[model samples]
Target: MTPQPGSYPGLTRRTLLVSAVAAAGTAFAGNGSATAAPALALRSGSNTLNADFAWARKRALDWVQTGKPGTIPSYWAGLTNRPAFYSRDVAHQMLGAHLLGLDAENISMLKVFATSATERRRWYPLWAFQFDGGIYRTDYKSDDNFVREVPAVFELTEKGVRQYLWTGNRAYVDDAALWKYYTNSVTYFIGAHDDNRNGVADEDGTGKIFQGVASYNENGEGLLEAGDGIASQYQALLAYSIAQQARGDEAGAQASARKAANLRAHFEKNWWSASANRYIRGFTKAGARTNFGKENSWFLPMKGLTAPGPRTDAYLDFVHKSVSDLPPFNIEAYTYLPETFFRWGRVDQAWKWFRYVADSRAAYPEVSYTTIGNIAEGLLGIEPNAPASALSTVPQLPSAVPWLELDHVPLGAHDLAVRHDGNKTSALTHHAGPRPLAWTAQFAGRYESVLVNGQRQPAKVSVVEGRTLSSVTITVAPGAKATAAV
Candidate 1:
């Protein structure tokens, strides 16, 4: 049964107020309902660069609201000229929305894309859509515009499934209409475009690295193969696998998983340059490696395809070295590098780049929204795994900032408020859902014990990419206040 538009309701103010609280300690329980807590509020002042943070937060909230209906709910790429839902721009925008916990807005936009079928066939959407649900342009034409048919439809479908993962709302996931669109799009991408039958979709025999009309660099000119396109396909395969698993299709999930693995292997074998110590841009038609440090090299790590080590470190270092050569807020690399560095525990470098985008106030939704996502998801590391009933906090607090706090973070059926000060941490969960929730807190430094609701729990130490992280996990009842101290 497909859920109709507006089927899912937004979170109420009462729910937000009931979930916000300032506390310390951990309390694990099997059965508990949400309890009344302080209203949700973000902390202000010197530690957080309150003025800039406040502006970014408000901008994200306001920008999401500006989304108007098109074939699917769509956001304008920019305020000045482009007034359509572009395939790549919308994907980045929706990802930012998800990071900010704007589930409803994200879902609305997803529905628009999910249901937009091509005119020639009721399957995939065209490259772009006007505000009135009309096709603005497509890559269907041969010659210069041929790249439009490069199978970027999978990117939108992947994001749609990601929205379902974040909200765990059946309205988006189980909607028959959306699944039909998603399955058909994936099928079309595989059957018509994947000429090699090796699980990767290529551009029409162009011998370019990526055959899509759009490149992550935002340069829609020429027929150069792009690393970004290949990485996007890899992500699409993984996302499809997740969708399959969610529907209890074990064989389908396994098949997609195998395909993703094969694609990764293929990408590494062909694209990696051992001498350069990082993946190059892409290969030319004559099997020549374009050995330049293009921004897309960062995409591999951003997609979780790279393990943490010297190679990953070298990649980050390359990005750092390349920054001076790039324009101010080089939209392509800037959008992703900060989050990548933060996730890999390079807080100093992450903060440096993050400050650049925050200061720029770039108007492109793709740039600004991604900057906002970096602050929330990158520095704060507030990952909401709703389907698993868990919220993971891995704060990358830099040396300059003494503390940081985020309030009213939407998790499935709950609003989570988290505050971290140096090595000590505090959190209050206002669970609106019927069941209890589990929480995990990760710290970069070494910690022997973590106090949960004032009771000490043993901390587990794990090394990720050469950096040691101490993590503690505990279960909290709905409406319970818990805190951890290292």
Candidate 2:
């Protein structure tokens, strides 16, 4: 008998691979086969203010002339050679504005966010919107309303406006600088398309063709990016405010609409993924294109202006299918395994690899920064940013557990089979003296562990869903040293 796909209802490593590859294709056109993709998923306790995701978005936008700016990470940690924070600023500002739609007050909270720079005067002073020349039409000093960082000034206008919601500090909602910088922000798509700053023009604003060098890294390696990251970020928020204002900010809104056109054009000309039947990251002149992982969920559909249309529809398809069932709340950045494309004839083998991973994470648990924050939170923009920070302090899962501490109901995707002797378990609870969670192991057979806080106790492990070390038959391993994290 053929194994029914959704019946087992567990995440397997191979399943993850299958989903990721398939997602890349359907990223544009929905997979015709609904049987393979589950229409809905268990809405787990998740947040959008993902530390890792936030950091990634921040990397694109957070910039400070003094090098002390706080909202985005000062410098990225993992990459040996830092790329000059690239398109992250646009991503952050747009993402932040998207958050604002959910809560008006999130704007003012940004003032406290940029702790690195105490110069509120230089940034968006909270009182500006009410008193600025436009919008509320206030009479504050609008000449010196410049903020630092190209991306921040260009896209963070919504952030400043939000930040200024209560402060009445007129400087925070500075829009003059924003109006001036919007074009340069998207036009600066370097590398693949042009010798200048931007490339071809979209149907909005002035017929300004975007031009930017294909310079991805400091090392001068050209990359496949039609300014997708930057354009998507800019378009998401820009279109939103434009569409919202309608006849209000006519010129500004029109410019934003034009930028959206440009984004659409670029995607069609340079970023559509043929193999996956959807949009992928942009491509190189060499016909090579990058895969869309976690970021793609936002990057692709954001051009939709947050209204119901193809972009929104595309995003909904992804939320309902591939990512909702995968690990890390997205497909892995890129597969290390072979023949990873989903629609290929060898899909079964590729899926086998993918399912293997999903199963493993389901049984064990997650430890990485990204998986816990962004993916688990159902943050693919389905609900905006209402509960963005719920998992800011999410606890780690246990690597080794005699019994699964499933209460209420299992909130994670069914991917892995967790089998163990529950009777051997005595007590399981979070250790809070120095660490957050530490479980006492009365008896241990085999288990997976994730260290939540920095502490070692009698025996307790912390990990996210779909993870576990192969059943360890540990009659007695060395007592966990205090140095071990729970």
Best by TM-score: 1
Per-model lDDT: 0.57, 0.27
TM-score of each: 0.80, 0.32
Which 10-residue span in candidate 1 carries the lowest summed lDDT? 2-11
Residue 456 of model 2, lDDT score: 27
Residue 189 Cα positional deviation in candidate 1, in Å, after optimal superposition: 1.0
How far in Å is the alpha carbon of 198 misplaced in model 2? Answer: 7.1
Clashes of each: 13, 95
lDDT tens digits, residue span 422-467, model 2: 3232222221111121112212123344222233233333221111
The alpha-carbon deviation from the true structure for residue 421 of candidate 2, after best TM-score superposition, in angstroms, is 33
Give the Cα error of residue 153 in candidate 2, in Å.
Answer: 9.3
